[model samples]
Target: MEAMLEHHDGIALFTICRPEKRNAINFAVMGALEEAMEQAAADPQVKVFAITGAGSEAFCSGGDLSEFGHLRGTEARQMLMRMGELLYRLLTFPKPTAALVNGTAMGGGCELATACDFRFAKEGSRIGFVQGRLGITTGWGGASMLFAKLPYGRALDVLLRAEPMTAEAMEACGWVDAILPAEHWHEQWRERLAPYAERSLSVLQAYKAAAGEKWRTAWFREQFFAEIARCAELWGSAEHEQALRPFLCKK
Candidate 1:
């Protein structure tokens, strides 16, 4: 499976299951994620929705360049818009959401974390918004979400630096809610999330609705779509193509 969804103890854990590719998001993975989210949302027993990757080496590397690097022009725009929509849905999801960062999370992976209401990262994990390294801005509405969720300077630092930051550093910047011990992180996350999961679904949904109200505003949606469009334009640009060569060659 490119992705797997499991329901346990009122939590729906959606895992990206491609350890060999660092759990990167490919088209099939995207579809699976969407389906997982839908399934969790419709299940009355599911009080919380969470995401994670399959293995210890990486939470997610980002979009799979091996599969997506060949896309250009409208193809790129459509792909970016699809993921952007998914992230937006996650940000506005009625249930409480979390990202369990077991290892490195870069580029769109960081964006995925940003979309969640809380982020719990392993002690040794690293996180970064590194789309700048590819000569494009975040196409999944991650940058806009980061700006809304974090202080301006800190959000800019993560995006502009284009380098990975340790879990401690991300915690310091308020991006990470907690840093779990590297050993038995799955058990630790389950323990940590238990309290939230125990809450009534109505209570959790009400709080999430209030917290995500701004994301539903017309202004925010306009700005987010604008960002996605800008990124799509850059995705077809000479600079982004040139920057992607080194990464693609490795594939």
Candidate 2:
């Protein structure tokens, strides 16, 4: 499986397992992730959900363009909608979600981490919203979510610049909640999240529910979907198509 899920105590860990592809997301990985998330949601014993990538080289580089680059127009729009739905699920999930950014998280990978309630990265990890270089914008509702989590100017800078920043830099900007040293990062994350895992499921759900009240409204949904539509329109553009080919070839 390109994605794998493991459950221990009250924590569910989802790992993107394709290190050779820099843990990029493809249809199979998305499907596996959805299933894992569904399982985690339905299981009363699961109190905290966590996500990470398999290897140290990258948490996730981004979408697997080799698989998705051929899509155009409506097809690309549908792809954006699909990813949006998954990210929305994560963003408003009833349980606390943590992203273990063990390495680099670029483009959609950064979006995935953004959707989580907490983001903890290894000290040397890098992250970015590098879609500009690919002739696209953040398609999975990342810009809106990022703005909600960070200062408006910083969010704008990150999106407009489309540059990779160190985890330390991002934490300073209030995007990354925590930055851990490379060695024993996983152990440290466990210690940090363990307390939450021990809490009752009902308590965790209630707290998340209260915090997510604003996001549960229709306005946020509409705005998120609108962004997806906008990105899809750009996905079929000549600039996007031209940039995509070279990026995939280099990968």
Candidate 3:
């Protein structure tokens, strides 16, 4: 499968397997991810869940905007909702979600990691909210989560400047929980999950759900939709279209 979904010892793992695309997420990838999350939720044996990219180049580049060029009206709306729903699913998930950010994380990649309770980054990886470069805010609730996690100035610097920061820089800003050597990132992550695996799955789920209470309310979803609607309007504007032009020209 282009998207990898597998379970191991009460720890369901999701991997974005399309390294050739820099682990960029397509609609298919989104669907697979949603399915995986649901599976993890349903499995009594699962406690802590983790997601990451297959390779070192990228965690995810974001939506396939080539597809965006073709979408209009309802299709565009559906895309927005799908992206938000998937982010919501991850954010409100009952289990403690972890993101093994093994490489460069930008745009939607940042959103994915932001949804998790812990982001375990690989050393040398970088992270950014690149949506500003395309004249949009974060497509998911990343901005809100970022503000919750970062000092105000740091959050403002990332959201407003749209600058990419090295994994170390991101850690300095409080974006990542831990950064490990790329050569042994997987091993270290497995070790981290070991303690989680030993914990009672039910207790883990209960505590995780409690932690997500503020972040995953109906009111929050409403706010998120309003924010993304603004983004859609921006995406349809000349300035944003102009910004996205270069990505279209990439061969």
Candidate 4:
């Protein structure tokens, strides 16, 4: 399975399971994630939802270039919209959501982590919102979420520089809530989430609702879709094609 879902002890764990490809998001992975998230959200017993990638080498590298890099115009638009919708759902998911960043998270992968309510990183992990390096803006509403979650200056810095930052740096900037030692980061995150998992589902939902109300507004929805549309238009641009060529060649 490209993505695997496990529910146990009132927690739902979603693992992106393609370590060889750095757990890049492919169509199959995307579909599985959507389904797993739906199941977790609907299950009354699930109090916490945690997302992580399979190996320590990477949490996720981004979208799978081999699967998506060749698309253009309308096809690219559809792909962007599909991913945008998925991330938007995650951003507003009712349960307490956590991103366990075990290693590198780049581009859309970083966006995926940002969509969650809290992010915990392994000691040496790194994250980068590098979409601009690909000649496109964030297509999954991550930029919007960053603005909502982090200080304005820091969010602007992340978007403008398009460079990776160490987990330590992110923690210092308050983007990552905690940084655990690499060897036992998985256990650390589970402990962090344990308190929530023990809570009643309604209590968890109420806590999420207080913050999620603003995100659920129609104006925010417009901005999120607008960001997707903007990136989709750029997805077919010559610069984007040129920028992604070397990566596509590696694939």
Give the winner by TM-score: 1
Top lDDT model: 1
The digit string of per-residue lDDT tens for model 3 on 202-247 reads 7887798788888777777787777667666666767777887888
Candidate number that wins on lDDT, 3 or 4: 4
Query: Model 4 residue 65 lDDT?
Result: 92
RMSD of each: 0.8, 1.0, 1.5, 0.9
TM-score of every model? 0.98, 0.98, 0.95, 0.98
- Residue-level lDDT tens digits of model 4 in 1-251: 79899876888999999999999999999999999998999998889998999978899988999999998989888998899899999999999999989989999999999999999999888889999988999988889889888999989998999999999888877789999988777678888999999988888899898989999999999998998899999998999999999988998
Worst 10 residues of 4 by lDDT: 182-191
lDDT of 1 at 2: 95
Per-residue error (Å), model 4, residue 171: 1.3
Indicate the TM-score of model 3.
Answer: 0.95
lDDT of 2 by residue, 109-182 (tens): 99999999999999899999999888899999998898888999999999999999989889989998988888
Off by over 4 Å in 3: none
Question: Better model by lDDT, 1 or 3?
Answer: 1
Question: Clash pairs of candidate 1?
Answer: none
